[model samples]
Target: MTTHLTGSRDEWLAARIELLKAEKELTRLNDDLARRRRQLPWVRIDKEFRFETDEGSASLADLFRGRSQLLVYHFMFGPDYKAGCPSCSAIADGFNGIAVHLANHDVSLTAVSRAPLAKLQAYRQRMGWTFPWASSSDSSFSFDFNVSFTEQQQREGSIEYNFAREPAFEWRSGKEGDGASARASFAAMTGTDMQTYTRDRPGMSAFAIEDGVVYHTYSTYSRGVDGIWSMYPWLDRAPKGRNEPSGPWWRRHDEYGRG
Candidate 1:
């Protein structure tokens, strides 16, 4: 095994210089990534979708709420699901603060979910969030944007692709005692509409700012929820047992539960 030695002053200085070089390389890599992210093509969305807000029905254009631009977050809160996803809940928690700042910049942010207006409002109240959230109970918007699933697909235990061209699922199970099996039986309901057949493709929203609007800006599912938490100093804590995780404020936020 090759062990690193730190004995003389020259050796320590060399190690520090190497660390600074690594940091500079990291900075250069991050700049390259940002440029690549900005190079993604933008898609124009002209189709209008409807949603239910606190002020009643509103069109997708109306979601801009008379502002020049709008940013919609496709929050994961399907109708049949018992509660909003924990990971999504964490993001929504961040949105409360972000909404205020975005508005100050003349940008409006709204969260869209498949849950009914009443249900969403109740949960928002429970979470004590002030961000504007709307319900897409009547629109095929989620499916059109690929964020929800259909009833027939749920019943068939698979997803029909390309206008009934192909069917896909995780696994198939045999019927009781008959030994007859389906190819994909592990499918679950996407909790979307039945009539229009909306597919469940989570994270299908857009980000709009000055100059132009960007569709499907960025999306995430799980544990990476910690990605944005570093922005808040109060929430900035290292992982357990990594270096220092037993600071005074580490456990102080437990009273807030999952928030």
Candidate 2:
């Protein structure tokens, strides 16, 4: 008979102390990262942009909609694109649930896209989304925010890429075998999928509204998705992962089944 001796009190205490130390380190790192984020330099946006809302056409100021802050998710539905980006769609789905909480925080969140009002509305309906989405079809808003490209610029092939809105990722791989000892690896991909569109920029623009005027506060993209749905670990598994089907509650858009 073999009797394995359990760890003594001192060893258990030492292990717990180590865990506490690791936790403290994690907390410090998080605080430092947040402080660095706050220290990011700000750029002044002195231009006026336009958008079309359900009420009517309005300037960037109008997006505030009587709120103190405006957070706009630069959705990846270009004016000429047939559909919205799948990743952007995923983000929108999550936004539908948090719009109310944002309102409580005095921050108005909206999704903005380069598509025309009618087209955007159609897609929004297909997705069953109720969150506010506006159209920047007629304005240089998208181009200014590095989310759009002009036809002439595309033709010239000298268009400046919007690094601010591009997605980035890291990939790794390994081989596996008994005799060969295969290695395995993983990759982390970020940013929006802008390949379908002629232009490849997608980002979020945040504005602060004061006294009936809107001021561009901050804008971010690529890893910005990390702040939204990606923050929820379980969300990564929806649709194909662990999410259960809605049965009859789900309906396919008429347009989707045609093809």
Question: Considering every candidate listed, which one attains the maximal lDDT?
Answer: 2
Candidate 2 lDDT, 19-72, residue by residue in tens: 899889988998997687556655555687778998888877777667788888
lDDT of 2 at 229: 56
Instruction: Judge candidate 2 at residue 235 and give its lDDT.
Output: 51
Clashing pairs in 2: 167-191, 174-183, 175-182, 175-183, 176-182
Runs of candidate 1 exceeding 4 Å displacement: 1-24, 151-204, 209-259
**Cα displacement (Å) at residue 21, model 2:** 5.8
The sequence of per-residue lDDT tens digits that candidate 1 reaches over residues 153-214 is 65565553322322433211121121212111111122332222223323424445344443
Superposed Cα deviation of residue 145, candidate 2 (Å): 0.7
Q: Where in model 2 is the C-alpha error above 4 Å?
A: 1-27, 39-44, 151-200, 235-259
Query: What C-alpha lDDT, on a 0 to 100 scale, does residue 6 get in candidate 1?
Result: 38
RMSD of 2: 9.5
